[model samples]
Target: MEAVLYVLHGSRVKLACEQAISFIETCMEEIPVAIQEYCFLELADPTIEEAYARCVERGAATIIVIPVLLLTAVHAKEDIPNELARVSKQFPNVEMRYSRPIGVHGNMVEILMERLSETGKLIDKDSMVLLIGRGSSDPDVKRDLTTIAGFLKERAGIGRVDTCYLTAAKPGLEEALEIVKQSKYKKIYVVPYLLFTGILMNTIQKTIRKSLADQDKEFILCQYLGYHPLINSVLRQRVIEAGGGQDLVSRHA
Candidate 1:
């Protein structure tokens, strides 16, 4: 039998971690495979090795490891693979295949649109957008986010889409605020390109609320993407590709 080993980047916040596990459960139901288990990379229980062992114990001859990450960061590109490699050395009889992260998928655009709609704000030519991400040291991560911002700018018909980072990268949120301060747009939407709510989301929200309290500019913060149906669809597609003998190549835009 074949199984799917879903890996999520665990968070210290309980709600955030629970959200990832919930997403994994939903993915398990949507995926074609019957046997599936989930684990976290760090800061949570049931590490990757434990999850892989559970799959093997269920009599799985092949295991497809799917990373539920948004970018090609170190976690997706190095840490998860290293853990899988260590475990694969122990399970000589079972074949292990790895899949790419859900980076720059088109469905994500739909999810962002849904989030924007939920805010009850209309996108107009005078509206500005700030696509904020949990920044990484990796250059590819920034490049992919910039590409996503460009797509949103064109498709959503917003006046401008500025890319910013929460930390560890250029154009931090404060700098982004400085840019927003100079812009004459009536409304600026701060879209967080995150999977679930955590310290970062709270921090961003607090910062925006405090800084723009007395300003005339309307600053709207959209909800983070969490367990959306489109995400489930993307997970299923990645599993299918991995099970079909495709190698784990860089699939980002």
Candidate 2:
């Protein structure tokens, strides 16, 4: 039997974990597979080993592992793969395939734009967008985010879009905010490029609130990207490709 295993980057927040579970469960229902399971990469229940064992116990001969991540970072490149490799040794008889994260895509840009639009504020040439990422030591994280910022600039017809990180990269959130504060643009939109709500989301809200107190500029903090329908479509495409649906993958490629 064939199986699909969705790997999510777990969170310490209970609501964050619950949101992940809820989103994945909804996605599972749409996939035409009997043995579909989800596990966390860290900070949550059902480790990768536990989920892989369940698939094997349920008579799964082949398992396709999909990393539910926003961008290609160290967790997607190293940690998850390392864990999967360890479990694959035990399941020597079973064939396992790994899929890519939800990397740079047009759909992601649409999600960002929709998030900004939901603020009910006009996104005009005077509006500046501060695109924030979860930060990674990997250079690809910065590169990919910069690309997305450019896409957003064109998509929204904005004059400028800036990219920043929460940690491990420059300019940090504080530095980016200070720069934006000094800029002429008064209408600033801060968008968190994250999948779900957690400590990071809370921190962003708090930080923005603090910034608002001191600055005269309008700092509009948008919502995090959480289980949007476009994301469901993206994950479905990834699952299909990982499960040997090469024709569909090639179409996107």
Report the lDDT tens digits of candidate 2 across residue range 1-253: 7788999999889998999999999988777778889999999999999999999999899898999999989999999999999999998999998999999999999999899988999987678999999999999999889999999999889999999999899998888998999999989999999988878888888888877776878999999888888888889899787877854333433
Off by over 4 Å in 1: 245-253
Tens-digit per-residue lDDT, 180-208, candidate 1: 88888879988899998889998998889
RMSD of 1: 4.0
lDDT of 1: 0.86
Best by TM-score: 2
TM-score of 1: 0.94
Clashes of each: 0, 0
- Model 2, position 90, has a per-residue lDDT of 99
